[model samples]
Target: MANNSDIKRRDFVKTAGAVGAAAAAAARIQGAPAIQKVKAANNQVQYGMIGTGGRGQYLLRHLNSIDGGRCLAVCDIYRPNLEAAIKTSKDKPKGYLDYRELLARTDIDAVLIAVPLYLHFPITRDALLAGKHVFCEKSLVFKPEEVHALRALASSRPKQVLQVGLQRRYSKFYQTAKQMIEKGMLGNVTHVYAQWHRNPGWRMRQSPDPKRQREWNWRLFREFSGGLTAELASHQIDVATWMFGAEPEFVVGVGSLDTMKDGRDVYDNIQLIFNYPGGRKLMYSAISTNKHLSLFQGTRTEFGEVIMGTEGTIEITVGTDDEPAIGLWFYEPGPPKVEKAAGVKEKPVIAGATLATTGRGQIGLPILFERDLVTGKESFLARELKYARLWLYKRGIMVPEEDRNPVDVELDEFFQCCRTGARPKADLQVGLADSTAVILSNLAMDEGRRVYFSEIEKMGRTPEAKGRKA
Candidate 1:
């Protein structure tokens, strides 16, 4: 929670513990006590991939787009996905029906395990034991036991890196927001509200074979996925955890699978409340109905968190690249506009003068501040400064944002971490914590009772790290 001005080139590295120690020790040997080195990869790391499904293909695209390491091979149980992976690979990375065979490759320095939630632990466990760094997707482990075990394995191999695919952790805008939050922009944030509403779940592939239907539409099942909670809610919950500067102590919720009567076991609408120890709460919701909440321009059903604070509120959404990261802020009714009754009214100045609507004088904006928006403008700094400086900005300047993908940034950061042997922002602990939220929340909804985060089996630690943010 350091201020922006205090953050140096390597300041971010200091935020992590074990990896930061190694980095700091290395810097010390060079007669300088740098805070720590960003746990970015040194470009010598080579990556192997497992699972070439659509998600896996997306990772492949990111791998090919950025440099840190190249994919030497990919593995999948399915033939079509393997074939697609081969075509996707620039080096025409070797394909294997068995992930074990791919892990055996000598050239592979790290592995990107992109399998479903059920397969996450075994694949990741095997990769870690193979002495390969791991970049697994979110909900790093499905059950409580895997969380304990994987964390222990990671601890045993302290030198190796393990990162979760919570992309926002690597985003520049999100990081900037974190910095802003730490700097007291929100003045003791109080409550957060978020929602993710979509239509008919995801389009299920037309399937004759039951196995085919299950494999392709894993998201719709309970045994395979936690529906939107693990698949979608995890991201926003992570944002809540980040912005609140702590993890929730407990969760309570109500959910029903009223819509999408398409034999999907997962709920269609879920409303959850996470309770932080500081008396703060995050009210979160997700529904697979009409994707219409008017947040993030309706591209997404759930726009973002409405971070309420003493000073003001911020709306944030880490959304599609075609649009951009969305955010806007409203200053709390500035000190109650006072009206002076000077001439003949015989009355003194009064506090309440002008009234406003709930979300007034705020602008919806692209968070990235893209290059095209900066062109023809003198300076981005000027635009930002001018808008913020005004008492009331009559001519609001547009914030520029990238029309391209944010996964690019997320992947690049992962590679950098792998090469440098540094801990990623979304390291093992962050992923597990987010997963904890999911598991506990689901429990809360199912049981019709409040579920404390502590109620779920805590991962890794034999004796809990009680009271500290999970």
Candidate 2:
């Protein structure tokens, strides 16, 4: 018998081979649309960036590669952030201290917002009212009222695009996963387990100036942040809800501020279970003490999700700045079917070779190809080639990857939508639903109760409801 270490080594080699082959094969794939360059003036969307903080700067780095949009203006309350944005950009953009000033420009057709959680609503609302298309970062709104408010505002501005910065929605790997789920590839996904464990947690920096301190450590305070839920868990929870194809009915959870004591009120650790329709559940955990992820056999860390079904399981995660997103599937093994002789009684055998013959751990199948690529419409040669590649993929000779990073794809799509008035994949409705989950999930932990997602319908009706926070 092979040792576990030896088996793992073999599995690793196969996985590596499959990934490399798939990546190489994807480049030469026929029938794929040619990559178009965004050099024409009519093809480009004029945009401004607001709140050029860490997240904002991160987006700017990605924006460097994208040409479909041009940054006409940059805004940040902090002078350094504004300067950094100006320096990072290829096109010279006017700098503003107030975001409203940036929004006032008529030349700017859209805005990319990467502000703190609390400011997400006010900024987005203001930008929409300014008649510019908006692409705001994730956990779209800060509070319940914002959810209702933004929805109403976005509905009124049907001409303008409002896209949320949930890059996974634009990822090919994720889209393929969604298609697989729809096609029963995973066989009735019943449960999803997600975790985002980070070491050291959010930095607790205190400035001599009170306002600066608050601005610097907004993530640590409960008033401005939803802690781990809004920052990390929201992404994974959205993935769960998306893959399940339904909203969660209710959520129950607990949160604790035990680990890092730095005068911050938000919890350092959290665990929640979302009960969706059809008896499906999404179990989640976020902790500050560790950064180890159990998915992909500990190959990746910090964040990932496990989708479990009757026939198989899928472990998936989106790409970071350094790592590309990956998805792997493992099929469940059942007892072998045996045919009995007609009218003959089966007897128990004293000696059994079943244990010796049975396979140990199952090898993971890469969730790679698009449904249409291997479907009925393609030419026989194309279909044959796809199947042959699939055969290689299953044998761990090739694994698939997206042609471009999701972040870049998302930004480019946002720009295109802004110009063409096309609806985005991660539009306002999806953003609002994700925000509602974040708000209610935090409330579930805070109030020590199982909170229904439907509560958001009536949540912001009154002043008291409007002021509710995590």
Candidate 3:
């Protein structure tokens, strides 16, 4: 059904995609060594999980696949969650009501803290004091003081592995995107747009015991959570910061408790703009009314980021269980070049004329993975099969997937870091910066003004402010 020219064009595009994928793979390999899996039981990093709530159980599900870490205990005040966590662990870990009791165990070489935002600091501090490595979920600290305190404490214990649960750092697709940025594929990136939208987001679950309702729905309260900013936006903010290679100078935002008024103090919808250095900006939005995502041709929803630049744009999002992480590259057309007379200097073209000649919107190309890279080491049949798969991917017949989930990869890396005494990719500083963004963004919304990032140095430092909430 296809003409020879059409087949040749398809082959050319496929080959080009393959080359780009190989370059990305090579770049990532150059940045860091390949993750080595530990199979020996004697080398397993003994760890304890604190929290065992929904997030804790989710991590446990991923941890079950990683053999480098052995969960020795799980702690939670709620009996059901503790039991659920114990059941989830392949190691049949001991259950504890008090996280400190679990931290007290000399056998626990590391602690994975998945408690609510408020408890993250206290538990992490305790775990560090107990001489156990810690992997805490993000929006790493609750308040500004905790940010400084945790940084100081983690610095004091440099030998211990302190990783934040910002899993995009471990994602291959994200790594490739970063590599692309570094390689000048996306020239002079100046703006990023990100969103995590949901229709009727985060409903309050009724507890059998009415007294425990507030405690259970911690995310809905200002006391226990930073709301959507910490829970959702923190992740994307980290992505923007990572891409930009710097933190924002100032943040301005508006938030409202508009729709879901079930006694929750946190906002149901928020829109924010983070002004980074060099005139760059990250515009963000998280709404509860709509789940539409403008990324990936709207094939997906809920969350994604768009990085815009002079030469190209990247639309990306980390994958979930049902979907593979996707990164799409759209190349921007440069202004048409005018030929000058021989040995004559040419004047700059007018902006209006240049704008008219600049080309139309481009069809996006898939930012390929290592699997898509053709190293030319494969057998004849292997090469053919790889080509077939690439064709299928380009035709939307199939999607390219990461060899492992980023969540699983991050957890595995945490355990590996624990064993090797290596610094995690999402180290203490990265977590602290993310937390600072959360604190300032909330402050910006609460005060209804642009909040400068530098104010964090003096904030929560005074003795009087220690007792007060920011």
Candidate 4:
């Protein structure tokens, strides 16, 4: 037999589920664009891959399933990576030792760049100069001069599509979170806490040829890499900027090479605080010590973000292959209203002073997706399946999932933009802004001072200015 508590819990679940479904339905009614598929061979965007290393191969793996883009050529300085990229792509792309040789081919319409940080600008510039549309991975440029140069180059080629590899912009859950913020669901979002903590990060790899060791371990050196800021914090920093609807005004941070004393020049741990317009803040931390995450009841680890507001809070993170993306919402309870004492004319007396003194813990609610929402038009079986899934979700047995991975979505969108001349969500400007943050962040830590975003205008202007401290 069901007890009163069990009956009340079921009722609350039903009500909350209905509310979530209604929200989804409202979003649908507002005309959210459906995912598009490209099937025609002629309509496909013919593209080439440059720098077929780990990131390049990862993109190729996702690109294999994306019908909108077809890979024609792949290039890498290293022969093994080129071969691996060709094997990863279903299209059997032609492999090249020189990216220039691949770019010289007029048949290729666009190019995907996943080279190391130091090489990102030169290859992207060459590819653009070759009249190919470009999709470059994030921390788009290495130095401040590259930032100015790439912006100028991209602006000159107005017809060409230049997309950055920030996949979160393509995520549906992220989009929904933005909508919730706009709707004041998380009222007046003021602070965001983000972290990417890894245990024993970036092990050194031995190269067969001694000469290529530096090339293999480029990320460990400050000469080639911006280290943790460019590689890890860049993603979450973009998230904070996106959610805040403004760029950061200034940033101050501390970085240290405390662990992994194996000739690596970059910092192993970093903690930063960024101040945006309207006094909003984003606190970030990335460490090489542990992989524990406090969000989602410690069920996940490594990376996640917490957005806090006056009325509510949201804990969100992008998904991995083994786990789905999670967005947990918590509502802050309003303080109890003071009641006037019987027949008293003075200011309202506190109704139970003890009740108002204690903190009320909030229960987290799952942010529902489109599939979790039920329309009246669903078939009997479909509706029942949805209900069962909702029940499981409420019971913490299952979580909501995206219809497609954001990587595939971003790749498909890039191809679509190439074909249609549409602008990408993560365009050149977005990439530049992210890169600027990375550059300034490193400057702040190295110089031990607050670095202003406006300082980028003065940086890398003249040859001598590049070496000047902020």
**Per-model TM against the reference:** 0.78, 0.83, 0.85, 0.85
RMSD after CA superposition, every candidate: 11.3, 15.0, 15.4, 15.9
lDDT tens digits, residue span 1-470, model 2: 11212112224235434543443355347432122223348678888898787889889889989988888898876677788999988887888876656766767788999988887877776666666788999889888777877787678668888999888888887888888888887788999999989898787876645655765788988778888999998888888889999999999999999989888899999999999999999999999999998777677888888999887888888887778778898888666899988999877775776678777876677877564267778888888888888888778676677789999999999988876778999999888888999999999999999999888887876766446543
Instruction: State the RMSD for candidate 2.
Output: 15.0
Q: In candidate 4, what are the lDDT values of residues 253-364, reduced to their tens digit?
A: 9999998898889999999999999999999999999999999998899999999998889999998767889988898777779888999888567779767778967658
Across residues 1-470, which tens digit of lDDT does each residue of candidate 3 receive?
A: 11212122224235434543553365457642122233336799888898788899999998998878888898776777888998999999988876656765666788898988887876777667666788999989998888887887778667888999999999998999999999999999999999999999999989756866886788999988999999999999999999999999999999999999898999999999999999899999999999998778778999999999999999999999888899889888787787778999777877679667555776678888766777899899888998998888777777777889999989989988877888899999999999999999999999999999999987878765545434
What TM-score does candidate 1 get on C-alpha atoms? 0.78
- lDDT against the true structure, per candidate, is 0.71, 0.81, 0.85, 0.84
lDDT of 2: 0.81
lDDT-wise, the better of 1 and 4 is 4
Clashing pairs in 3: none
Model 1's alpha-carbon lDDT is 0.71
Q: In candidate 1, what are the lDDT values of residues 1-470, reduced to their tens digit?
A: 11223222122223222333443365457642221222334544577788788889988876786756677788776677788998998868877776656666666777888887877877777666666778899888887767777776688777778888898776556765676577787688889888877766576676545546765677888877887789889988998898888999989899997757777788878999999978999999888776667554454554566788897677776756456666666566556576776685665755663444334455543333332223447577766654563423223444444444668776777777766676788888899899888888888899999888876655444554433424
The C-alpha local distance difference test score for the whole of candidate 4 amounts to 0.84
Tell me, by TM-score, which candidate is best: 4
